[model samples]
Target: MGRNTRKRRMPLATKIVAGAAALTVGGGGLVWANFYASAHEDHSGHNRTRSAAAQVATIDCPDVGQKIRDVPDRARGEVDGELATMDSQITNAYQRLATTRRAQAGDAQFVQNSILGPLKDRRKAIIDRIQLEINRAGGKADDNLDELAACQGRPADQMQNGDGQNGDGQMDDGQNQGGDGGDGNGVAGPVADDFVDINDVQPNTRDSRNGLAADGDGGSTGTFTTDCGVNENNLFNSDNLIAAPGVDNGAHHTHDYVGNQDNDAFSSDEDLANADTSCQNQGDKSTYYWPVLRLQDGTQEFDANDQGGGAEGNIGKILKPAEAQIRFVGSRQGDVVAMPKFLRIITGDAKSFTNGDANANTSWSCSGFEDRQVTDKYPLCPDGSQVLRTVNFQSCWDGQNIDSANHRDHMAFVQEDGSCANGFQAVPQLQIRLAYDIPTPTVENGQVQNPYAVDSFPEQLHKPITDHNDFINVMDEDLMNEVVDCINRGEDCQ
Candidate 1:
């Protein structure tokens, strides 16, 4: 249960072969008994089969959080609580989907009828409450909010894998595994096809260093580094203060936390400001956190039976990072301004699996192969090259609010030419570079061994594309000014 403490156990990957079954519509439901393939090794060593029978991989629901905007300040708390409830509902439904393979195989419509249908009804009630809260507070909720309540079961093969394409040429929807969720793999996701050999990936035209940044004639080139121990105290939580401030287990996944020590679902700005700092410099009390990475080797973690861990399909041994490098860089366009105290920013989309990759901001590569970063797949680093996860936060601030209704409108990414959009100002950008010493997974006979994945919402199926980062600025005024000044002066500082 402690740091680096894992019970050594190799989980066996048992192969399940599909048997003959009929696919038909019976009594207002579709039945495809015994046709769904079980988890097995294929000739190509990829975790998928070319069988014509369709298999339910994961559930896809409209992201209610992203669609609900213009929430009044007075109703924000209630809206956020209901949204967190929605996340929990999705997690529960996914857990059922993962454990009910026999039912899913016996009846193709079991997932839609027993899981997704009830889920939509619950979500409709939640959305109605959200609308009522907003309307009660003098804000108009969207008329189409009910449309977001229904969810559908997507076939495993239709999901985007490392290749970023599926059979129908639909954009990646994160899933790439076959069969019902879990598919006897123990963990729910990150099958062999989800990973790609780093050597096979073509070099991306966009430089890995500034994937989110742009070229500019005049820009601040300086950098500021902050030494924050990589969760040395093992601070972990399943809550996201920015997204679901008052809801416990808000994230539905474990997160490795470093920096302000008092962060939780109930922590307020004052609590965070007064909290102890994990950073080497006491002046910087900002909290940085992201989903914990886990190895699918059958080692149960401290939260193995807990709601956000094994119970939510995020089972495995948690991997502590070898290095956590937190740095602040200047805007690519010009001198940067100091970030406001208590600013909350979330980069990347945690629900990108079903919501699409429009806000997906993942960067995975090996330490030596940093030049070739891939967003859709986890990199299988060669020996001695540690796995790396780099994240770049948005640097364009709207100049007024530290937070927004959806927690995004107040900040934006820089444009192609490195300039902020009209009315937005350049601010120091935060970049997190995390390195892990994980064993390279093997794909022998289509069976993935020792696979690793980031913890994600249960329905997200532990896809690498769902990797995201969270931040809350609690730096003191003077220290923040120093950071801005150092970047503006084109001088590196610690």
Candidate 2:
């Protein structure tokens, strides 16, 4: 058969699903993603620009070799040395290729034949060495490097073209797989090479103070006030916070619990009703949750790989604000009106990690400093400062529904002019400003632990700025009454 006829004669299933990925939900709402993309260079034996070459099909190569600890101590040094050399080689080669692409002057074919081709070969070689190291450490190495090493460290089936999807510098969808960025994985990798070398990160700036301070020296928090303080009872650490309110392990990510510390996947309205609160009033049992913003308290870097899975939906770290301001604007209005109890709400996009950029609602700044902002990756704050994350949520409510199908329909942000958007009805605006004292990793009892790290879901590595939060109001009837009275009267209450 002719080549075109032969291609058309391929398997029916493969032909039906071929292209970039789009998620599908089954009857049970379980996510089913169909991803089909070429995993290797197109080789139609035609001497043309690789970009114009006809595309081919390939299977995904799942990752391997993260079980670095399994490598025996004796083999570790050799393995480390080999991997380090590979890192340097690939990074340097890509650096040059990227420079060529930018200049738009180098012969693309020449660069590919001379530089890119060799770099890809080096990448192939890395798989064997990585597997050897893993096996030497008494761990099993994946039999195939297609998913792990394909595209030279980029995730197996991600969109490559500069469709503005990931920061991966690939031009459109059908170009060289090794786009720019560190190792082409959207990660800067562990500060392995830069450790002890650089003294500061880019866009570093000084911080200001919260206007909500009792002294009122800084930004304004409006009328919102709380008795919740920092402590084990008010603020607890939990790794598995159920995603949906009543479903266990639903979140698949870790979160810091503030206020009602007894919260978990199975926590019910009654459970919260009877639970003791860390709020000073003792009657304010509201529960607040957000992905933990771990501080780098030690020398080691805590990564998404350690305990959390590295899958895309599993969750990664690093969520930041899309803009450069902090806002606390509106709430419901009326006399003697009370918020619907047990209301559930979530703000900020949860898919920021996979989307490759934080939504505008997400914001970040260095602790003690407010002039700078960071996204895409965690900011390496100055030596003694901490990473401060400020995430704001919607304040306006539908005034009738406690929650919606998506849990957010009942709540909304203020209007562009700072007026309540959902309706004239108002409620308290909720926002959380987290302060992280990022410390270097330290050795505890001879075991090294990463101090500045977050706990999220598994499956895909996460950056720090993908910060998320959850809240459930368990306010007493009296306190809710007081809040309603104060807001209706247009008086700020602490």
Candidate 3:
């Protein structure tokens, strides 16, 4: 049989629809009306550049270990202080109670003393609570001491064998051996010649982005930018766009639904012009009317009116200002771009501008700024009919948007009375970047490692201290050193 040769082509309409569908499915379409461009334009007006200076330095593993060991001890100290305070308060209460009882016995018409009987009972209860807490603290402290002992034992075992090599290869036996402690595991093994000496205790050699070793000359710059908009024209699809006040066009509707016969009824500019003509012809006879148009991008546009002078048909009573915002996601490089001071919005005499209605003359015309962008010269719209100019915007420390599928990056509108900060007329895209000099982990010695190390001993033992009041708490520093010593000596420190 002859080979079949056929080329399948989709209709133009189908192709267009498919293209749009693809974009939306991939999160790359104008599903909403927003635009975001790199705010930090280089000299060529293109890409923005961010530079950071990181220092490369060694972090003494032993120091980290020590910090961890100190945590439990600190918590225990706090518990002790609290118990002492409680004791003092109880003593004072008892003294007052004794004096008040004597006075009451002598005087026939004695009033209730403010700081005597009732206070004494309350203080007694507090003292009881303190005692319980102290017991718990003591217990936790004991547990910590036990754990420390176990860790110490591991290294003692390795030291006994004279095998100075640690598990992580960063420390050796001689470096870890101290005092009378034997091999960490309480067992002896063959010692190796590679054992490090005690005097060699030093910082672990590792590269950290924020460390001084990473920052060569420290002459770096960065920039940052924030953009705010409305009508789906910014990076974020702001939630400020209000739903149409009347009935749903299709499946979505409620009791207050007001039917629009022409809903989704127009598909071209000419159709809208025709609708406008019909409005003019009906004149006063028309209770409600709308001229619909299709933009070049295929989105529907509508201009509506209610000539009935009734409450339901008033266009001026329904609209509000819409907004969208874009924020830098990560930290910038050299010459950092500071947060923006202004957010701009468009305003006009139309019933709805950028998906919001100018419902009230006063409401739509008021002008102000939010956050740190407040200033004396409040910019207003050109005609003074509405406030549309840029105003100062505030910077938020934790304002970076994290993509959690909840659309949290979207901006919300702040009402005049400050009632609902989350109330929004639109949503915007949020982006963030880590600031310069911030440390991030990278690969080292063929293994992934944390560039910013934190003390872990306190966190690990926190629950025990919280639960057992009578425990002797271990210090973070002590625990950290013990771990380092164990690792260096190839000991079985738990």
Best by lDDT: 1
Clashes of each: 1, 58, 118
Q: Mind sharing the TM-score for model 2?
A: 0.49
lDDT of 3: 0.19
Q: Could you tell me every candidate's TM-score relative to the true structure?
A: 0.84, 0.49, 0.15
lDDT of 2 by residue, 327-439 (tens): 12333222324667887766654434443332324555566555565443355556777566666666667777665533445666655444455353546656677665555
Candidate 1 is scored at a TM of 0.84
Q: Model 1 over residues 131-201: C-alpha lDDT tens digits? A: 99999999999989999899987776532212222232222222332223322224446766688899887
Ranking by lDDT: 1, 2, 3
Candidate 1 lDDT (Cα, whole model)? 0.73
Residue pairs with colliding backbones in model 1 are: 45-446
Error of 1 at 15 (Å): 34
- Give model 3's TM-score versus the native structure: 0.15
Model 2 misplaced stretches (Cα beyond 4 Å)? 1-222, 234-243, 295-337, 355-360, 422-424, 440-453, 487-493
Residue 215 lDDT in model 3?
11
Instruction: Give lDDT per model, in order.
Output: 0.73, 0.41, 0.19
Residue 372 in model 2: lDDT: 64
Error of model 3, residue 479, in angstroms: 49
